[model samples]
Target: MAHSTDNVILQGAHGTFAKQLVFRQRFGQSILCKRPKKSNLSPTDAQLSVRARFLAASVYAKSVRANPELLVLLVKGLQ
Candidate 1:
């Protein structure tokens, strides 16, 4: 039998993060995105998370519609 976390792995592998695992890990604050030892150029996990959150907020702000009903419908569809 598959473990419960298998579903989460399946979703991560086949869903939007399929092609961007690094970005996904960064958003989740996973150590996978951490800068390598002795590396000075890459952004730290916290920095990447902040940037991802900012981008998400910007997109969500842009997606807000004047019609409250439309937003409700959109949320339902996403679920």
Candidate 2:
């Protein structure tokens, strides 16, 4: 079976009793095209940079979508 949440997607594995999972954790905040700041920019800028790097790396992976189980774990960890 497959399930969805606010930030994750979970599904069972094929030909196996185990389950598959996807999590959509915000790699970081999105950024707009603007001039750079002398003070190293704001938090949003930093977050956006990190997210971009993460996506760049993940795009090369086989299955880079979010995992539901991992999402659940992340949520739990946050709490």
Candidate 3:
């Protein structure tokens, strides 16, 4: 990681650039660094379990959104 200062282009810059570099702000200073490469390892059993649960929750939320009655009931606290 490298600290950036006095660079007009990098001032207040945050996010990835060209998918090769990352710009972030830390402790009120601008930071610039190379983007980390994705891991090649497979997911662990615990990770798979969490992913499955997340998918189920996402599907449930989508179903609720698709059903107007369910959405209104949820927003009105089942009253």
Candidate 4:
């Protein structure tokens, strides 16, 4: 699962053709995906990398916000 801005993308197995997933916050659980055309199959390597980074960053941001003291726990070794 990958997220950016207001949409989330999920790539099953690999970024193969027709495996692109699109989820919008406004959709309220309903997701959409576009099948790759004959000319294009799967996201480019760079695109995948960027998506992964975005997802990681988004998750990290949300996690930190949810638990403001997470850093303290990590640094203090579960005291």
Question: What are the per-residue Cα lDDT tens digits for candidate 2 across 1-40?
Answer: 4433442222221131223322222334222222333586
Off by over 4 Å in 3: 1-6, 15-20
Identify the superior model by TM-score, candidate 2 or candidate 3: 3
* Cα-based lDDT at residue 35, candidate 2: 39
lDDT by residue (18-76, candidate 4, tens digit) is 46654333444433456444765689999999999999999987887688598667658
TM-score of each: 0.32, 0.24, 0.73, 0.36
Predictions ranked by TM-score, top down? 3, 4, 1, 2
Which candidate model has the greater TM-score, 3 or 4?
3
lDDT of 1 by residue, 1-79 (tens): 3223324543443223334343233343332232223556889899999999999988876677766887888889999
On residues 1-79, what C-alpha lDDT tens digit does candidate 3 reach at each position? 5544688987899999999999889887888789988999999999999999999999999999999999999989966
Model 1: which residue pairs collide? Answer: none
Task: State, as a TM-score between 0 and 1, how close model 3 is to the true structure.
Answer: 0.73
| Clash count list over all predictions | 0, 7, 0, 0
Predicted structure with the largest TM-score when compared to the true one: 3
lDDT of each: 0.57, 0.47, 0.90, 0.60
